[model samples]
Target: MRFATVLAVPATILGAASAATTVPVTYEPKYDNGNFSLLGTACSDGQNGLVTKHYDTAGSLPSFPNVGGAFTVSGWNSSDCGSCYQLTWQNNSIYITAIDVTQQGFNIALAAMNNLTGNLAVQLGRVSASYDPADGSKCGF
Candidate 1:
């Protein structure tokens, strides 16, 4: 009886852990110049320079083109700084680093937004998304 109880507990925990949380996802226009400085972010002062170390610039377009994001304070806490989240929209998904805080929803860089929307980010500024804590490997940790 004891062994069965322990087994059941583990299974229940695993089942709950596998569930992803859903949120609204929007795009911000800060990556256009390829500048990934953490100067104005909430994590700028305390994340051990993780954002600067991992965020990379890709192009000089006038649109966001990076794999970074800001989460709403109500949904994510300070401990999530420098963490990664997999954002899914429709049939697309992308991994983004949490480097800042927003007022509402997950505000991702435009590049990540475009990817998730199949290059329709301009047409679809916001989308409903399912998010899960993901391996930071994809976001360069």
Candidate 2:
């Protein structure tokens, strides 16, 4: 149960060019070949029973309207996975795939991001996320 709490700014504030909204986003650590929890999903094929990764899907819990599958990123649209986005904090920035969404999808483990552990929450400089075309990148978002 590793998690990192991040402040998401509304896309409106960024400009009309985007429609993303402000929401509290928490990212957890995920590993390759991990099992899908009741609210979990997978990024590759052959992993049945779990929802296949999709752009429109959000890592929502099974209790949500479409059960284990629903593509809702608060301010983003469905079928928007094949896009590339940037997450910036302080002087660090990482490019991520808008690839998989889960009701409980783990983005990147907080442990890898920072060495500290134990469910800690920290405020980062005006966190900004922006999206662009995926450009044929692989390895899942």
Highest TM-score scorer: 1
Task: State TM-scores per candidate.
Answer: 0.68, 0.34
Mind giving the per-residue lDDT tens digits that candidate 1 earns over 1-141? 355443345666777845767788888777434665665566554444334444334232112354455554323326666677778877688877676677765887776788888988889888888887777676553
Error of 2 at 4 (Å): 50
Give each model's whole-structure lDDT. Answer: 0.64, 0.33
Worst 10 residues of 1 by lDDT: 55-64
**Model 1 CA deviation exceeding 4 Å by range:** 1-18, 47-64, 72-77
TM-score of 2: 0.34
How well is each residue in 25-86 modelled by candidate 2, as lDDT tens digits? Answer: 34444422234342333332332222343322333321111112112321223354333443
